[model samples]
Target: MRRVAMMRATFPDALVTGHEPLIPAMTNDPKDRHVLAAAVRADAAVIVTTNLKDFPSAALAPYDIDAVSPDDFLLNQLELNRIATLTCVVDMAHARNRPPVRPVELLDRFSVIAPQFAEEAKAQILNQSEPSPWLIHQRREID
Candidate 1:
């Protein structure tokens, strides 16, 4: 619960509560109803998840929500805003502390989950004319 508390503290307005009454109404996996309830209460348009079976289309269609895979969602986000999406990835890499992870390294790790999106993201970062964000960051540290 410490991790949840930390998340709530970090993003106060992102929290949604009092959705338990809706849990019994959700048709997805019984174990995942709380998530569905929260999505319903939050009026989410989509629920990106690896466990597709847990959030069936029939179950979500009534609420006007779609269950999408994380890979597809990331790809969609990239397509919607290429530079901003890639920059967010670069920012995540930049925030790494104890064992710093560079953007290339982070993309490599992302491959295990979202292979196609990671490949395209890596290409965009490398193909861009500007020095890669990681290179610029490393150069700053060295100086």
Candidate 2:
């Protein structure tokens, strides 16, 4: 709830409510129904979640939505925009100022949560030479 509150605070207009009207028993798990309801309400293109089994492609295909694991999602982002993704990861590492996390340490942490994404990201970061348009835009926005 605290993290939700922080996200709400950060992106006030991005958060959607009134999902109750869209509620349906889309999944076997009652607890996961809310996730489907929210996606329906928002008309999301994709639902990024670790629990891919709960959101089978057959179930989401009807709604023109696909459920993707966080690993796959991050890997897609890394492949599409390697420079921006690498910059984001490096920025995240620097943000852990309490212990001053190194980029390798951050990648190591990601290995536990999303091993495929961590491996791909590390490879992309090491091989990438040119800055992506996304990274250039992000830097401009920050500056």
Candidate 3:
């Protein structure tokens, strides 16, 4: 609840909708039906979720929506705008001021949540310039 409030405050333009109309079950999990229903209501082209298995492509084809893993989604964003993505990553690291965060720490955390994306980001970061201490740590940990 606090996270949702923070997100709403941070991204005012982000759409925040109420309960969507119930629709026929699209996946094996009855609870996931609400997700599809919300996507249908919003006419979203892609649904970014960790639970990709719950949203089969065949089920989403009719609605022109595709369920994408977070890793794939972040990779696509990185591909579209490498500099912007890096900037976002840096900003995210800076936001963790309690203990202070390093770029590599952020990447390590991302690696746990999105391994494929973390690898791709690390490669990109390495290609751009001389590796920093944090980057070195990231490489050592990932290897």
TM-score of each: 0.85, 0.79, 0.80
Candidate 3 lDDT tens digits, 1-143: 99899998999866536535445645535778788877877778999988988888888888899999889999999899876786677668778888987766788889876898888886777664776565455443332
Lowest lDDT 10-mer window, candidate 3? 134-143
lDDT of 3: 0.76
Question: Native-vs-model 2 lDDT?
Answer: 0.75
Q: What residue pairs are clashing in model 3?
A: none
Candidate 1, after superposition: displacement of residue 7 in Å?
2.2
Question: Which candidate comes out best when scored by TM-score?
Answer: 1
TM-score of 2: 0.79
Clashes of each: 0, 0, 0
Question: Model 1, 52-99: lDDT tens per residue?
Answer: 999988888889989888789999999998768877887888888769
Sort the candidates on TM-score, descending order: 1, 3, 2
Error of 1 at 115 (Å): 1.3
Model 2, residue 119: C-alpha shift (Å): 1.1
lDDT (10s digit) by residue, model 2, range 1-143: 98799889989976768987666647535777778878877889888888888887767777788888889889899789767788888788867887887766788799976899988776655444774665454433222
